[model samples]
Target: MPNVPRKPRKQVAALPVMVDPKGQVRVLLITSRETQRFIIPKGWPMKGRKDHHAAAIEAQQEAGIIGRVHKQPVGGCNYWKRRSDHFDYCRVKVFMLEFRYQLPDWRERGQRRGAWLPVDDAADLVDDPGLIDIIRTLPKRLATKHKRLALKPATMS
Candidate 1:
């Protein structure tokens, strides 16, 4: 049998975390407009926009939260599904980006709704374990890094 090239997978940027006052962390989950499934906000990269910009936009549009990308893309996961015309699995790649921002006042959107879940409970709310894991580690990692840097001593004159 001859080897055939598979279709290139599309890239999607997702923001899975948000921080709130009282120093608590939350994961922003979105109900899909069409599927009604709980998912982290995500979207394809927009023209002339940076990856982080796309991520922020997705967070606002899907979750109705205003946030900024906190770290470099942590990682990604790939899965396969059949396309409209075929029985073969088409690969899909989902990128993970951590976001730091505050929740916005919830107003009715076209069809989607956003919810903020405590970091500990986020995994159960999201369908994908990969996304869950991302939410799990984000708070500790970000907090530790920020604290460590903040506590570092200044160099001697």
Candidate 2:
């Protein structure tokens, strides 16, 4: 068979964020199992899940935390996924997860290290350029969303 270039695989990611008492946005990042690089919780799309739900599941498994995940995508990033015999390109859709609480113990806790850092610091720590851009622009995106929400008329129900 002749070689043909494969299309980028689709993936989902959760950008877990919390606001400090000082109102600073902090992002939670986990170390990738193999590379130990800083990355948000992300994985392949589940067989029977909405993409955002799958991203939430990934966050629970990889980062031991859960939050309110936005239904719409905030942004996306492209990266090369290393496979056993080859590298595959992946496109990741990212959703913002409003931080709730963290579990003391969770799966993959031992396999990876998780940390909460200021947005700018986390943006600088991640290696993927696209992901970095997403992290950097997250605050502006959130502000835009908030403004839109404020503009909506209130409903009495």
Candidate 3:
């Protein structure tokens, strides 16, 4: 090979969330293994899974949370992933997971910590600017989803 440039790795992330009884939305975040920097549940592509499904798997493994992952991705972000020999830039596609339940134990439970915070706080905690931008737009996207859901009953009848 003459001088081919390296392509950024593609990854998927789960934007796990729950809505309180009062209608406030909270987002779930986890710490990265090495640096312990706040981040969403994310990982590399799986051989037999679609991007969103893979994201759900990552959430389950990393955060011990299970949910329905929205088929359409909410947004995406890019971050530099540190590797042994060199660093790699990775592009992440974030899928929203509407949490159903949390497990008591999970694969990465001992290796990482997870937290649920308001979107603003979650945005503040994460170091990635691209991820922060995605977090900022989530509330509007969620509101639109809820409004559509609220109107569904009327249209059904």
Assess every candidate by TM-score: 0.67, 0.88, 0.87
Off by over 4 Å in 1: 1-8, 79-108, 147-157
- Give me the displacement of residue 44 in model 1, in angstroms: 1.3
Which residue pairs in model 3 clash with each other? none
Model 2, 1-157: lDDT tens digits are: 2233476789999998877666667788899999898999999999989999999999989887767898998889988887778877789999888877777778887899878888899999999998899889877877876722111111111
lDDT of 1 by residue, 1-157 (tens): 2233476445555655545555566665667666677776666668897766677667666655554454456555443323456433222234343454434433335567667677778767766666667667867777776622111111100
- What's the C-alpha lDDT at position 105 in model 3? 80
TM-score result, candidate 2: 0.88
What RMSD value applies to candidate 2?
7.4
Compared to the true structure, candidate 1 yields what TM-score?
0.67
How many clashes does each candidate structure show, in the order listed?
0, 0, 0
**Per-residue C-alpha lDDT of model 3 across residues 107-146, encoded as one tens digit per residue:** 8888987777878999999998889998887889878776
